[model samples]
Target: MTSAPPTETARNDDQAPPPEQPAGRRAAPSPVWPGLRALAGLLRPQRGRLLAGIALGLLGSLLGLAQPMAAKHVMDSVGQGQPAVGSVVLLSTLVLAGGLLAGLGHYVLDCSAESVVCTARRRLTHRLPRLRVPVIEHTEPGDLIARVTSDTALLRRTAPQAASAAVTGTLITVATVVMMGLLDAVLLCVTLTVVAFVGLVVILVTPHIGRATRHTQEAVGRMGAGLERTLGALRTVKAAGAEQRETAALHRAAEYARRAGVRAAAWEAVSTTLSAVVLQACFLAVLGVGGARVTSGSIGVSTLVAFLLYLFALAPRVGQLVEGVGQLQIGAAAAVRLREAEALEVEEAESTEPDRPEGDGDETAPAPEQAPGSHERHRHPAAVAFQQVHFTYRPGLPPVHRHVSFTVPAGGMTAIVGPSGAGKTTVFALIERFYEPDAGRVLLDGRDVRRWPLARLRAAIGYVEQDPTVLAGTLRDNLTLGAADATDEQIAQVLRLARLDTMTGRLPHGLDTQVGHRGSRLSGGERQRVAIARALLRRPRLLLLDEATSQLDAANEAALRETITDTARRTTVLVVAHRLSTVTTADRILVMEAGRVRARGTHAELMARDSLYAELASTQLIAFR
Candidate 1:
């Protein structure tokens, strides 16, 4: 379903505001011209096919013109009492040939239009993923989907119909005018006078068509967004019994779109009616003026008949020209929205690895030495250190992290426990570089993380979000998302480590069983385990676990805690622990309140020194025990 266009506030939140128009610059150029130009550019790569289609359309139009002139010859021959059989045959052949050419031309133009839409969709698909995190967060996914699907599809209708009608209609109109002028200059002048007035009317109504079209398209987008919002949280909406309210909201959006569409149709209808009126007016003027001239012996009867035929042909062509302009306006409006989406800032593409040094042949060297008390081979865990980090979601907003400083040694487990909204998750976000700190340095393995290639930096770290996400797919698909090349044996190993092996055996299709949307078919513990297994598949040097056991039962949570502890022997582990039982055994713990670390020590040390930590241990932690 279509949705309303995003509001100015939504657009601004999704992207930086448009640059201010320069002083003295004519109010920002109409979106129509710029959008049309951009739409034309999309076809530039396929111009060969487009031009061929256009040429064929013109050929068809020329052939169509030939039919009227041929009919005039037959009429003239019959008036002279000639046999006229050959002329009749010639006219029949012209009609057949014109139909054939027109059909072929239409087919080719339709294919070209499809190709243009496909190219647009492919570009948008590639571009959307490259957009920054903040932009994606603010923009509705449904609106973006609409742009890729419905908005681009509009171009399929727009490109060929608009181009063919505009080009072929103009060609036919001009050719017919020339033919009429040859028959009689006085009649041609009379016909053109009516056409001139129609042209003025069309020019006056064209802007209204564009404005209405843009509004209608935006309303459709909004409707789609509304539907998406309701459906995405279908359970919540149903549980709250707000279905009627949501449906009413969507109806309002749909009504707005319907009204805008009606307005556009009204203007288009007026334009079309004016074209038809112009044709009838021109025909009357030509017939009356030509009849008078013939009586004066200024033109032959056959010439008058031929001129009228040309005028008859000219009407549909003029109507097509007007309709084509309307289609072009609609297409240009869609193009403007597409262009706006494309103009948003995107993150630079990252390579999989950093550049290697010349003659550096030690790629397979032994792993770096593990920190004290660590016990695991292949331990090359990355040491993370943050120095005075300061960050906020927006400039005017309160900071989420204020001069945060901490370190997690290589190949050891560090736990961060704090009250809600204490910036524990924000710390993970900074380490992942999802958001940059306003001021501070984050180091990985004693080197500034900013200096590492983005892909390399991210590949070296694995993060399991607090609320795990399980895509709608088979167990195997979800497990292999991070490690597509992982072997069956490796998959089994992680499943066992995460304690998901037992559940896998009970499934009807084992690993092949569909997990359903967001793993709705799986138990909460299974879903969490699947998420952990997926992360473990990457074999990351630094693992970030945010409430990894939050949804697990006691048995499952105990198993997961053991897995985390075991994993830390070979990889650096930083966990945001909600239940103190999960982190009491960690090498060190950081107590955070507000946005800063209030204390740092082992569980025993912190419980002895910090009042908040002592209280939390006695309350939340002791209950779990």
Candidate 2:
């Protein structure tokens, strides 16, 4: 029979289960221009390539603009009864050169865009592992993944396309209009009036596109989050026969995304189609006015022809202007998402991480160094002391630790045993500094842990969590995750110490065998052994094992018990104990209830003097494995 489990308090010290967020709700949208500014900032690193693309684009537009004049010259030469060969050749050359340059510029801009996304992704991923525990706890992993993937991808199209179109399209459109004015002022006036009306419509429409795109992206994030939620626990869903239920839930999320996408497309379609329509309207107006002028000899036919050619050229450029504005809105919306991700709370000021590149944490662990008030008193195990500690998961909730205090001497097997909700696991969490105590100091070697640099503090401790997580990788990778520079000799030693050497011999590739996702291929006992072996390889000064032997068989449990007792001689071992066997041999034991230590003694001492300890032991709530 199960005893009342611990209050759970903050949940896993390493993996806090976050509260669910409403799918559609989010922070209020930031202003559009800031996101545009962010886009400009992203482009700054690629400025050299950016400038080259801009130059090529402008050159192409210039060539394109000159083609109308070449056509006019061709008409003039033909009317003059000349062969017109030179003018035709010039016109063909301008068209060909313009197309080639535009293509080259587009390719360059796209390459630069890819670089921008890569940088953004690196920056985001770099911050993720460093974010404060509470921040990650509150934020959705799926949504964060969306920002790194789909959100950054939006920048790829919008960054270069919008910037180039704005610069090159504006210049070319203006030049086209000026040339039209020079050809015939009356026709130019008619065209400007029509263009002005369309401009007003486009301005009104663009904000909506941005709003819709923003919503659409958010909906897409929800869909991704939903899918991740399902896949992350696929086995559980399959076991419960809830596949169709999850399918319907995900379908609803996808439907929301689809509806939002249609809204964005509607706004974009309106803006693009109107821009084209206005140009056509201007063309008809110019044609009618120029036709009357030609008949009355106010303007010659070649002049009319060149002016019409200018209008025709202006159509595409005008469309570019509209498209650029739309893409800018979309890009800015994406930028906002990235900006928010960057703003999440971090574990520290990052002063210690200055030398490392973003996403470079895997390459090398930071060399441990002492902080200002940190101690170097021992060549031996680390001592832990929690004094007058107070903690709550969040405000308006009962405190998880209320004036809780404990001290453990260096180099021993210390077990924390308690009923469910008694906050036993919280001891390890506080010692590791995964959370901060509200009212008291947690000391490592007589120095406040807060005074220690995060990297240095974490480096000194090796933690094997309750329900240990094994990432998808080789057995060697999982074992050496914490000890990045661990040698094969040390790995072999830990494997034998954890009773895994025999298991490895049976495996096809031994230590190199794939563990599958979360070590899905491994049994519960094997996973626990892997977790134990990983911690042992770290060679930590303080080793934390939360229920280290809870999943093992009788043989493995007895073997691991011996291993733990032996390791305690070399480094401090603190365990949160549920099984009676785990606590019986501990050098000392703390019996906790309602967030405070109620008893401290050996098993015999507790059994003799404490009613709660005696009751639990008799009932096997401090369970016998």
Candidate 3:
């Protein structure tokens, strides 16, 4: 039977389901071939360098073929009692030249591979910020890092080495077989038969190697994700005395990775052992057959000896070829992961027009700026209107905003008060176009927000989130993030407005003090003030404050409230108020409940007309007393 829809009470913030884990390995069907293609595409741009490397490799292999012939000539001369010093010296020269050429070829191949990896990393980095917000929300941070770091590194180490070995080894094997035919066609047939059987076995085993490697890489990613989760919440885990449980969880993930690696190693061992066995078996077969031919005088002793030497040379090439195939499988698996990351949906590119400073003549221009402390203004502030806007986080989920409609007039403080799940934050998300409404329009200054260039539209707005983020840097660095060109005077003006000037003066280094990781060095109230100061420096036309005073004590909260009120006189202010005191004096108030605006008016009007609003006001008022 179908379950009933969730009731309003069931939709509380704490009860919402966590995001689903990605399907990962199971989601991929036929990952190997696609990964191989991706690898090829990545290297395609560097094909010229790759081809040069291949040519050099082939030259080195061909030169190597002459060594055995030279040795044979030297042996024949020594046996005949002729002068052999010249032959010996010639043989040494061939060995030295071939080694040098092969070394140069290997060097070129490695350089090309590194270049491909660098390009892949750059693309992944560039694509990250462009990905849609929902994609980022669902992805694990550590797993994403694994793709860019470990997985790409695997591709770099494996692709060119494998390609060069496979190509050079195959060519050398064919050339050796041809030379063997010239010596004796029957012996050539025997060698060909043995090689053909070994090649078939390697081909049959190759796909399993790819499958095992793909699983191994995925397990490593899972392990990384688990560790990141533990580290991110380490303090909470320790405080709750759940360290043992988190440790066990991480141990299990590590064990999973270990098992996967073992499985891959097992497959690789099998491939290597089979290649070794092929070489040994072929050597015995050639020795026995060639012994009979030498005894029967069908082939000369020296000729048979030279042919056996050539067969000996063929063994290593064949082994290298098989090893290269195995490495290719590993590379292909890594390529699959990289391709998956690159395939995420990215945000639409911003308009081609260059971003102009605020108050440009374009329709998206910011409101006129007033002096820092000036309250006088003649022009109207930017107006924000929501007309029947609708949104839901995912399909089949209940809407977060159901035909929501409201308007905030220019140049005043407008406060939003709501229960935890009443969708107060969704309003700001729509206005910022982080999300698009399903049915209706969100207008900025009477123009649909979607029509404005994304960059320019954001430039005219400043937002302070409830959980303020202060990066690991000096105070000045964090404050200047949104306004890189802010002068010291402008910086001081914002600090004064945020009531942070006093705090800065007390610090040992003032603005140069390090914030530590995520601003752990600062007190909660100070961090919130710093966030406010950062936003103010932008001089935005529309300022969004989401629970901006939640971390402040009574004194700081009151000061911030006054500062907000002052800011509203010259620019539009929309705040999601957690405490009723912050909005009691707001010029207009919006009371929201169950994803709808239940009432909108002055605080007194809301208390007199709306029962829910009256209940909320009384609850907070009682707590305050």
Candidate 4:
């Protein structure tokens, strides 16, 4: 009879992987325009808001132009004789209104930017979960985090600011030049000529400024990666006494970030300050020639005053271009990094052409109802088989598992024992379909396993990892990890069978007692039993236990062995054994050496025949005793 399915959500690695180490020589940075063009797509949906922002910014820039003109009018009026109160009031009001408009304009632009960012974050967060396991396995967590969080934040801030500034700057500059021409056409010509030169300089410097900014963001991400590496290995570092070495490594990464940041800042400062300086120089020239024109009766003092006011109004807009250039560069750099992770290969769910019922002979047999452990419709009780399975992490790298072929039949417990790097864990990994074999097929009951949806296939087998991950929850909750939906009676029964029922009885809250992080609150043996109870709760047809008893003491180990011996009678058990006890107790042992099974037989038969088995039995079996 089938058992209750696990009610718990599939435990997942929600965190992103580290950034992929760049291959070979460092790639030369691409032109920023492409990144900017890519960013433009993000803005398309908010074009109406963007346009409104630009319009407001232009009005604000025009109002700002009136501020200096109003001050000049007040000065001229006072000098002439008596200043008109009405005129002064009107000019002051214009200046005040302009300031308000500028503030509102900024708000609108920022709002649009926020909208774009929200959309991008939503899209990326959703996509991350859907990504293939292999893609996530190959990626770096820190770099992906930087892209999703930090880089996107930068884009939101920069895009709107740049767009608004570009619009306002263009309008103000043009308005100022026109006002100057009204004062004295020849003088305006000289002023605008210098302004043109400044514009040219800004354009020439913009691309480089963006490149430098992008490099700065990347350097920062690398610093984060370094921090992650250090933290992940904190225990190892402490054991090895390598704190100083890690500190130095982090410092180097920080230095690179600092250098990149400084370079970006320097370029921004130079470009902006130059624009201001050139504008000032142009103002001086306009003044010198306008003074000559006024004396010659070719221009009025009021006209020259208004022209200078317009020029000063143009400064904020011009300054924005410089800052915009810097931010745009930063955004581009972030995009490149983000794009790297975005390009990961997401695996699709395999097609399941349900098995035909014997009498009906129809092609569409219902897919198996998913339970804690349930096989697909086509699944039969043959065995696990790898037919010429070839696998690799990346192209051109040596294959991790090459042309590996093996079989473990149903109804008997098979122990696969091998040395480190013999691709032992990889066998479990392939069976679970964490990755597809590059070439070849994995068969279960003579049917290619790849034909089954990964979820259904994994549900068919109970897996207990070496580390035996246990969440922080009640003891009962942990025991029912895979069988969340299991009834209390079923839970109580499993607890009794795994020999954890006595522990549960002693607990202050019975089964409800909280288990701390990774079940640290429990003893090693208790944790192992909890995992076993969890697997057993599913009444799995096929049980996969990976070094389940490695953490237990002798007494607990014996108890666990007894439990496993009982459970195996009702299920097909395959174990990756680290202990000789497990190997000896296993009905049959498959001794693996260098990614291939070298020998397979009962413990006594193998020990009596195979030299390697005999040697292992002598050394490790004695150690087990």
Stretches of model 2 off by over 4 angstroms after superposition: 1-25, 349-379, 622-625
Q: Weakest 10 consecutive residues, lDDT, candidate 1?
A: 1-10
What TM-scores do the predictions have? 0.89, 0.93, 0.91, 0.81
lDDT tens digits by residue: candidate 3, 405-521: 998987899988877667887788778777778888787776677766676677778888766789999999999987898899999999988889999999899999999887989
- Candidate 3 collision pairs: none
Off by over 4 Å in 4: 1-27, 65-93, 127-139, 350-383, 392-402, 409-412, 469-541, 569-571, 621-625
Estimate, for each residue in 453-569, the C-alpha lDDT of model 1 and write its tens digit.
576677777888776789999999999987788899999999999998999999999999999987889887788889999989888888999778888989889888998999999
Q: Which is the better candidate, 1 or 4, if ranked by lDDT?
A: 1
Stretches off by above 4 angstroms in model 1 are 1-30, 351-379, 621-625
lDDT order of candidates, top first: 2, 3, 1, 4
TM-score of candidate 3 versus the correct structure, residues matched by position = 0.91
Q: Model 4, 153-268: lDDT tens per residue?
A: 98887887887776667767777667656656787688768778888888888777877877777777777767877876576788999999999999998999899989988888
Indicate the worst ten consecutive residues by lDDT in candidate 4: 1-10
**Backbone clashes in each candidate structure, one number apiece?**
14, 5, 0, 9
The TM-score between candidate 4 and the true structure equals 0.81
lDDT scores in order: 0.78, 0.81, 0.80, 0.70
| Angstrom error at residue 6, model 3 | 17
What lDDT tens digits, residue by residue, belong to model 2 across residues 150-245?
A: 999998979877888988888998898898888889998998998898779778998888889888888888888889889888998999999999
